[model samples]
Target chain A: MSSFEFTFWTIVGCGLVTWLSRIISFILLKKFRLPTSVIEFLSFVPIVIMSALWFESLFHQNLGHLPQVDVGNMLASLPAILTAILTKNLLWIVIIGILSLALIRLVI
Target chain B: MDDVLDARTGLKDTLPTVFGYIGIGLAFGIVGKASGLSPLLVALMSAITYGGSAQFVMVSMLVSHSTLLSIILAVFLVNARMILMSMTVAPYFRQERTWHVVLIGSLLTDETFALSMNKLNRTQNTLSFPWFNTANLTAYFTWIIASLIGALLGNFITDPKRFGLDFALVAMFIGLLYLQIIADQSMKKALQLTVVLVTCILMYIGLIFIPSNFLVLVVTLLSCGLGMVIKHVLF
Candidate 1:
């Protein structure tokens, strides 16, 4: 296939995959009752998923590489993590994280 | 009064998330443009795919000229967590129509799921679909508009990292995760959190051998499965 064809198909494929994942559970649960254990299992999904996202963003160099600790990201995360633990406010944590990173960038 | 209050509260509660979305969305736009995607295509991806991390992965893959199958598989695996998220929130929408449920499901994201679940757990009020929709729509529009703005300004703002904006998504995730932990507030829950975190870190380190895309889905399943097993065995 041509490059343009490949790009078009790739985006279409991605859009389909993403939409299917989002709506699959909704479709399935409509017909079948989720086992209580499965529901209980699913409850922990957010925490686990979010943690993976956090770690990948903080440590990973590229998409699927070994996570080397970046000094800037690590330093910024300290304040962000602390703010998260203390305030439990999403906005404050983001603000502190950005400001901390900016400062670190300036310093080094 | 209650409806207005709920709507207002929903909008108010989502402001932080909206802020985070704009920041990340703009970053995605810049990265997308830098990766050779047109501004229109970046906005289109933001609108259609609407998965932040997956879109980032897509852009990077595009830049590298990765195959279509690999790109699709990667995006699918990265977003596979949405199935669990959709199911978890399904119980709350049991009373709504199928169309409404589907609509809500389509709009589900990490931020929306966190906010909606938090509200459901705390309130005695029935799950207000409209209130949830308000949060979803606000974040949705913010993402699209910010992407367009970023694409338009992509030429001017060459280096987004200089301002440290790349860390916005990570900070938001950390904040949301902390909130989830605090809301649970039990020794057992804390242990469960620890189990999940440990599992994710181990799997992340294991990425040296495993393909990154596959590891994410595997880690999510294994970690959440571990949490379930622990809850059953211990509690």
Candidate 2:
């Protein structure tokens, strides 16, 4: 197959896989009853996933080496973290984070 | 008052995501162009896959000439979390039509899911297709447009970091995580703190041993499982 054929097919396959993973649970569970335990487990999904993603952002990892903090991101996070606690607004937090990081890059 | 899902409200609620997605999308497009993919293909990938990390990995794998099946499988693994996220939000759409449910699920992403969940908690409103579709498409178009621009600009955007645009999504994640914490009314404060703490600690250690991609799915599953067990045993 040509390179275009390969890339095109690959993209199509990926799109199918992604959409299926997303929609399968909804279709299946629509018929079957979700156990209470499953519901409880689902409740924890948002916070747990968010926490994991957020933490992942604060560190960098290399193959065969321990993870280390990205000091730049960590330092930039301070002001955004504070804004999150104080205002609890998503837009403000993002703006503050970008500006803070921009300022940090400018200074050091 | 009847529950309504106006596009305006949805667009307003999803505004924050626009900022995050544009920067990351630009980065993805730039990388795609550097990988020898055309600008049109890059935008198409963004539209079709609609996944941030998975698309990035797909681009890298394509550059390396990974098999089509392997790319599909890897995409599934990276996005397995979507199944869980879909299920989490499914309860809200139980009364909606099957087609609507499918539509919402197709539009699901980490950012959209978090934002919707937080909005639901804050407003205590029923989830409607109009509201969600509006929000989803806003972020969706932003991402695709940004990718196209990035591809077009290619070498011009050499370093996204110089402008701190690299930090946009991270900041968004931080904001969403904080929102989740505040919006969580399910578990007690102590348990919430424990789950988050355990998630970070376990993920930190897990990253050392496991590839970061696999670690996210495993860490999320383990942390949530442990949180449930703790809740049952203690609370």
Candidate 3:
């Protein structure tokens, strides 16, 4: 198939499945009740997922190299972490983080 | 007053994601164009699939000349975590109409899910649909616009990382995790710290063996299961 044809079909299939993945669990759970324990467990999902994502981002891995802490992200996190503690505000944390990293990049 | 607050909160909460999306979305567009996709098609892909990593994977696969079937399958695997995420948030939409539930599900993505989950917990399991829809729409449009601009500016623009735009999402995740931990009073502080610490170590180890496409989903499941067991034993 041509490149355009290939890209088109791939996108169509992907979009369908992507939408399905997001909606399937909701559809299934609506017909059946989730156990109380499962609901309780779900409460922990946000923190676990966030921590995993953060770690994946903050640590860098390359072919044949052991994962190493990202110095830039680590340094940037200082001010962002302080902001989170000080105000617990999302926007402030993000702003401080981006600006911190930008300045760090500028300096180094 | 309450409705206005809800809408304002949604926009406020989405700010970080909007920043992150612009960087990543522009990067994705440039990559797509480099892979020989038309600018229009690149934006359409963002509008359609709307999965950031999946789209990137797709373009890379295109460059490598992977079959259409494999590309679709890879996209599914990369995005499979959304199933677990969707289930976790499903209970919130139980009272809404079916159509609304479907809308909520499709709009769900990693960043938005994390943001909405925290907001839901803070508000005692109540999140206004309009609030979430607002967040989703903001992210969605920002992505489309960014991608289009990147594609149009294709060769002229260099790397997105020079300005440290890539770190925006990482910082946002850090902030969100901190908030989630502080907002939850049920678990002991020590246990919460343990969960975060262990998950990080396990994920680092997992990355050594598992493909990143599946690593996040696996680590999240294993870590959350451990957390539940610990919480069950204590308090």
Candidate 4:
């Protein structure tokens, strides 16, 4: 298939998968109750996923490669991490992160 | 009407989400456009997928010319947590019409789920549909608009990275993680952070063997399973 055709179908497929994953549980759980253990287990998913994402962003480069630290990204993340802990504001964290990265770039 | 008042309250409460969405959504659009997606296509993805991280993954995968199946699977895995999130919030809508419940289910996102669940837990009554609906809609539109504007400005402003917009997603995730940590405030807070850190380290090590796309799913299940086991043993 052509690239455009590929992109279109891929996006459509992704949209379908996303919607299905989200709605299916809502439909299923309406009738049945999950075990308390399972619910408690699931509560940890977000923190795990978010941490994985954060680490992947900071470290991973491409498929099947060892993690390589990008100094700029890592240095910039220090201030963002502090802002997140201190301010606990999403917008501020993003703003401070971007500003810190820009400043770091200017300096080094 | 009561519906209007509830919506107004919901919107007022969603101001922080609005700001967060605008920043990250604009970054998504800019990255999408920079990676050669058409402005309309970028906006369309935001509308249809309505997933922040998944859409980012989609753009990167597209740029790398990854297969359609891989792209679909990656996006699915990254967003699989939504199932857990949706199920968690589903009980609150037990009294609502099935159609309304389905509509609300479709609009579920990490941010909305977090906010709505917190509100539900604190409030005495069932969460009014309008209250939750209003907050979802505000974040939804804010994301769409921010993305469209970013895409439109993509041609004129060539380098988004110079402005450090590339870090937006990571920063947002960090902030969200912080909120999750603080909101729990359990005595196990340190243990929870340790689990997250250990899982990330393990996933990083797993990169040598595991495909990059599957790493998130594998690590999520592993870490969460480990956490449950530890919690079960301790408490």
Chain A TM-score for each candidate, in the given order? 0.82, 0.91, 0.88, 0.80
Pairs clashing in candidate 1? none
Give the Cα lDDT of each candidate: 0.78, 0.85, 0.82, 0.76
DockQ of each candidate relative to the true complex: 0.58, 0.70, 0.66, 0.54
- Residue B164 shift from truth in candidate 3, angstroms: 1.8
Stronger candidate by lDDT (3 vs 4): 3
| TM-scores of the candidates in the order shown | 0.89, 0.96, 0.93, 0.81
Q: In model 2, which residue pairs have backbone atoms overlapping below 3 Å?
A: none
Best by DockQ: 2
lDDT of 4 by residue, B57-93 (tens): 8999999988889889889988887776777677667
Clashes of each: 0, 0, 0, 0
What candidate 1 gets wrong by more than 4 Å, as runs, is: A1-6, A61-66, B1-5, B124-126, B185-187
* Regions of candidate 3 where Cα sits further than 4 Å from its true position: A63-65, B1-5
True contacts kept of each: 0.65, 0.71, 0.67, 0.65
lDDT of 4 at B27: 77
Clashing pairs in 3: none
Please write out the lDDT profile of model 2 over residues A25-91, one tens digit for every residue. 8788778779999988888898888888888888888857889888888999999889999988888
lDDT score, candidate 2, position B29: 90
Candidate 2, superposed: residue stretches over 4 Å from native: B1-5
Q: For model 3, state the Cα shift of residue B150 in Å.
A: 1.4
Query: For residues B1-235, could you state the per-residue lDDT of candidate 1 as single tens digits?
Result: 1224266777887887776787788888888877777788888888888888789888888878888898898899888878878888877777778888888888888888877755654565346777777788888889999988888899889777887777777787888777767665433665756776676676667666666655667787888888877776777
Candidate order by lDDT, decreasing, is 2, 3, 1, 4
Model 3 — TM-score against the truth? Answer: 0.93
Compose the digit string of candidate 2's lDDT tens values, residues B1-235.
1134687888988887787898899888999998999998899899998899999989989988888899999888999999889999888887788998898899899988988878776656467788899988898889999999999999787876767777777787888888777766755888888889999999889978887876789998899899989898888
